[model samples]
Target: MGRPILGLRSTLKSLTRRDIKSYMSRRYSAESVFITATGNVNHTKLVRALSDSIGKIKRSGKAQVIKAPVATRSVKLVKRDLEQVHLCMGVPVPSMTDRKRFELYLINTMLGSGMSSKLFQEVREKRGLAYSVYSYLNLCKDAGSLVVYAGTSKESFGEVLTVVLNEFEKLATELTIEQLNHTKDQLKGGIVLALETTDARMMKIAKDEIYFGKSMPIKSLIKEIDRVKLEDVRKSIENYLSPDNITLAAIGGGMKKRDLPSVLK
Candidate 1:
């Protein structure tokens, strides 16, 4: 459900205790549970503590299942009187377990994840078309997306879009081995740096458990990343970043629906 808005009452009034109990009974089953902890901790004590509390929750025979939402290849434009135009373009990718997962991560880092990335240098530093530009991969259990976002003045929106699209198109054909290695090193450094923190390690452990059913050792993950080749990156780009698969979303004033096709093309 969407967040309830203040001063605007929802169609449904306050929920009764029975409604909440029924919903929890269906959703919070043992099959849907996971517990993760980091730092100085006793597993047995933690389990016991949890058992004393959440263990009382009755398990439903099975947890509720929901279908994954389909990815759409459409453009949506939201007009508003704003100083800058915001644009997001995305294309679907495989799930986290796919062999191309690491390659996709490398692709994002090379494309825009940091100050040294292509989008950052070209779109912001050189052209000054946008103040913020980045690309990221969102991976889920059954689906994923590679999304690029940029915010620019309304006058520069079209130019920024063209530059973003050109960058994506280049990935399919012009990615270089040197660039690939550089990005891989960058990603490896990032992984090592992230693991150095307790909170980051905790999140990594939780995500690995939720997605892969086990925690992967940092060395093992690094090995997989190191094994990624230039060919692998190009193949992933060709398979996933095709213009035909793209979806665009824009918000700002002075945007015409007709402009989307040309920009995306």
Candidate 2:
């Protein structure tokens, strides 16, 4: 109840119909809801039907006070008997609305999206340290982070983490013109490919509206991705990927927090 906002299994099991209804009554409101659609749809008819159904619900008038999530740098080591150790290293980054997010996407693609990525090439192709290694961006409305995940033997866990951390440190200055262009192309291709389906298009529409309060055309987004210069990427890395913003977490046997090298910065 103190920190677990979603509550645990025991707390969930204690919920009754009345409790759920009460919570919903306080949280669900017309002002907080959004409806979006894609494909052949009659907008007027859809709105009419929705108004007849959803309009009946009253507004709760509970002013939503959203706060940005705080990112604290620390290492969390969870002990467990397993064949391999799993780790997730993360650093704070700007929210989705930030202009730098596009560059961050390019950075993520360059760092871990494919076999050609730096992490895959160094960790799996060259050193044989991990079977799975990748980095991704997790951005919400007001806060976000870039996270890397890898799994390896306990003996190799420290080495893998060190390699990943070194990559993070090198990213600000080590990016090349060729790498930047290639990563830009990769990111653009992925974005275009993901919008081929109706559902994907629908989700994109919803997100664009939610984040920007307007519909952003794919061409505009592609153009923005294209406009991201090398300097922009380096600036974003300098701003967000510093040592003080990084957090490392691991789950495995034998490895403890003390065993981790103080290599972050």
- The prediction achieving the highest TM-score against the true structure is 2
lDDT per residue as tens, model 1, 35-94? 788999999999999999988777788776666678767888899999889999899998
Q: List, in order, the clash count of every candidate structure.
A: 0, 0
lDDT scores of the candidates, listed in order: 0.85, 0.85
Question: In candidate 2, what are the lDDT values of residues 1-265, reduced to their tens digit?
Answer: 0147888899899999999888788778777677889899999999999999998888888746668757788878899999889999888888999888898898888888888988999999999999999989888778888989999998887788788878777888788889899888888899999999999999988898878888999999999999999998998878777767778888989886555768642
Residue runs of model 1 more than 4 Å from their true location after superposition = 1-19, 261-265
User: Candidate 1: lDDT of 35?
Assistant: 77
Residue 181 CA displacement from its true place in model 1, Å: 1.2
